[model samples]
Target: MKLLLLLLAPAIMFASERTVTMKVSGNCGSCKKRIVKAAEAVDGVKDAAWDKKTKVFTAVFDDGKTDSASIAAAIVKVGHDVEASKAPDAAYTKLPDCCQYRDRTHD
Candidate 1:
């Protein structure tokens, strides 16, 4: 029981780590790679995944070290649009043709 308690203690203490999923506009495999890379670039982000069809990005991070807003900002910085944040015009314009998502959203 003592050994089990020791193992469980770490899990309990780190329970604040969480995963958040939100809409992120994108169109293809390249978008997925870019989105995930942007998300994981944020400090404390443990993992990130983006779904092209759903236009959703999911990220796991230690809440003690980072928050959803910070992660979203990182994605925006890399030219991806998150639900609450928009990528910069210059960065968005620099994306490859297949990665351009603004026109598709308008359509």
Candidate 2:
């Protein structure tokens, strides 16, 4: 039992839950949905939320399985721009008219 506990200690220590917040570009309800969905889709992400008014996105995830970079990449892939990653032109262009935040003045 002592050996088992010792062996599992490292794994338990490595699997820490972390919360990260960053600015993301978005405009409306659809944008919020896309942002949250993209962030939450990453492996190890427990949950995610976005506030359109503030353009801030927050995510809770296991550091052992994922990191902020991966979460940002997921959001970028789905047509949103996060502090660590930018959505590709193709992805950005695919956004709906109401969700196109880049053309306007925003954070």
Candidate 3:
């Protein structure tokens, strides 16, 4: 039992919950939904939110299973540009017209 406890202790210590925030390009409510859904879909992500006004994507995840880079990749896959990863033009072009933020001058 003592040996088992020792084995499990390191894993427990390393499996920490972490919160991360990063810039993600998006325009409106549709973009917000897509961004949040993509971030939360990662294996260890517990919750995610995006503020359209700030273009910030925030996520809570288990560090042992995932990280900020992985979360950003997920967002990029769904047509949003994250600080750590940029969505391909193919993916970006698929976003609905109103959800597109790149061509907007003020964004």
Candidate 4:
């Protein structure tokens, strides 16, 4: 009975959601629209907003289903630069001229 109680306790104590704030460089309004849209598109993301002043993306997501790093990666996947996340080289190079965010390593 005690073992069963302890196992259940951890589940009940776990968080359901988490909020994250992180930077992603961008140039203009189009970047804002694209970044915000991509962050919201992830399956477990609950909400997302971009701070133009700080160049940051703020997001809330279900902890049980998602995480901040994955959210950052998703943003990067769509052609932006987050602090710890990066677009794959091939993906970065394919962007239209205006969508390019930064120089990436050539392979």
RMSD of every prediction? 4.7, 2.6, 2.2, 5.6
Model 3, 39-84: lDDT tens per residue?
8889999999998888888899999999998899989998999887
Models 1 onward score TM values of: 0.81, 0.87, 0.88, 0.73
lDDT of each prediction vs. the true structure? 0.88, 0.90, 0.89, 0.80
Better of 3 and 4 by lDDT: 3
Instruction: Judge candidate 2 at residue 65 and give its lDDT.
Output: 93
Residue 90 of model 1 has an lDDT of 94
Question: Arrange candidates by TM-score, highest first: which order?
Answer: 3, 2, 1, 4
Regions more than 4 Å wrong, model 1:
1-15, 105-107
List candidate 3 segments past 4 Å from native: 1-6, 105-107
Query: For each candidate, how many residue pairs have backbone atoms clashing (under 3 Å)?
Result: 0, 0, 0, 0
Q: Candidate 2, residues 14-88: lDDT per residue as tens digits? A: 799999999999989899988888888799999999988888899999999999999999999989888877899
Instruction: Pick out the ten consecutive residues of candidate 4 with the lowest summed lDDT.
Output: 98-107
Best by TM-score: 3
